[model samples]
Target: MDPLLPRPVQDLGHYRLPSWWTPGAPRWRQALWLLVGLPLLASELPGTPWRQWLLRLFGAQIGAGGRLKPRLRVKCPWRLVVGDHCWLGEAVWIDNLASVTLGDRVCISQGAYLCTGNHDVRSPGFELKVAPILIDNDAWIAAQAMLAPGTQVGAGAVVALAAVASGLIEPGVIVAGHPALVVGRR
Candidate 1:
């Protein structure tokens, strides 16, 4: 093998998912949540109240008066929490393999992706790793932005369009670029 070449996974059987992680509800209940609950929650036909009702019914901790817009995908409703008057815009994907908490008045704009799971590249088995994500009060994640695992966006911060947030964002800052840097203060 060439020294510069990356090592491939030796044993796929050694891969193991985190023991702490579980589908919050029973298999049947989870199935129902995915099949029945998700569609209704993602529909534009149902207003905020109806969408919120569906989310709550599936065990998500959604506060009052938030708008969950059409076509948004939430992997695990039980692992999500959104505070009062938040807005999740169209086609936002919350891949919450771990917990994702959004504070009051947060706005996640169209096509933003919040991901809480990744793989350890150094591990021979390519082991899975997960961490929680937090978007504090009044933070705005603009269109097409991606928030990686363990990221914390501070209060009133803005992640600009198509940016990727892989670390902590200071309060009242505006960030832009692929790795997301502070461009200005809010």
Candidate 2:
């Protein structure tokens, strides 16, 4: 018996795709997103305003005074809504298979990932699941923080650096650590 032997079965190793799968956009829009939209936004050539404009052109609802840094990987601009005076730092990845809404004054710091999609482990075919992520007004998702699907950060809440947040973070609470426990209140 080899210690490095593989598991008898792996759901994802031999998974099959569902017949009804789609990229959530029409073929033309997906082509444009892949060809032009993602590349432009990921580049440092565009200034903050131009980047915002580009995202808007691809159907993102962006509000005033947004400071968007480069190297962002946004899965679908159509599923995103960013509010006034929001700041998104470099390397922020929005893997929004579902909707992601950020309220006014929200700040998503560097290297933060907001993921709105996951795969179900129980299913033999590895079924995909998606849910919306909501970050309310004045909330701060600190650097390197990872927000899981269906996570909601309430108004004035803070998800500290390197925190893995899921479920609801109550208003004005500061959460930290994996599975993000409430550490303080703002």
Candidate 3:
């Protein structure tokens, strides 16, 4: 939330976005990405390179030798940067209101959600809040896991399935559970 342009409303019905609020791109571009992604790029075919190409066209900086599987949903590819040899599994949702960076050899397993946006509950309007997420090299985000905003997953770390991770995760650690506690080391 922008403290500079905050709109404190008395009720939820009266809530409105701050004048400075923007989706970081034109509405048309956002629609176009959906049009291309849902129909073509997200297809359940054998064209990983084509999918990556389409993502690149939408301003995603994707490196080589990566596989983005079917049903992956990337909200605003312009805010995304992925490195080489990465694997984004099926149904992975990257709800990036801010930047999301994934280093080389990172694996985001199926149904994992990477959210760069949240709401400030303290605000009257439940104001939008955003922060960047950085997953370092060789990190493994397992299936159904959720990475919250501002999460910095360290290199070679493993976030176990269904774990919800936030803040900084140390390198080579294997984390599990709701808040992602340290279970082992890679």
How does candidate 1 fare on TM-score? 0.91
Alpha carbon deviation, residue 25, candidate 1 (Å) = 2.7
Candidate 3 lDDT = 0.90
Clashes of 1: 0
TM-score of 2: 0.91
Candidate 1: segments with Cα more than 4 A from true spot: 1-14, 44-46
TM-score against native, each model: 0.91, 0.91, 0.89
Worst 10 residues of 1 by lDDT: 2-11
Prediction 3 TM-score vs. true: 0.89
- Model 2 over residues 86-168: C-alpha lDDT tens digits? 99999899999889999999999999999998888656667888889999999999999999999999999999999999999
Residue 70 in model 3: lDDT = 91
The candidate scoring highest on lDDT is 2
- Model 2 segments more than 4 A misplaced: 1-9, 13-22
**For residues 35-78, could you state the per-residue lDDT of candidate 3 as single tens digits?**
76656765677668888988898889999898889988889888
Tell me the tens digit of each residue's lDDT in model 1 across 11-130: 577777767767667898789978888777666674677778778888899998878888888888988999999999998999998899999999999999999999887778777889
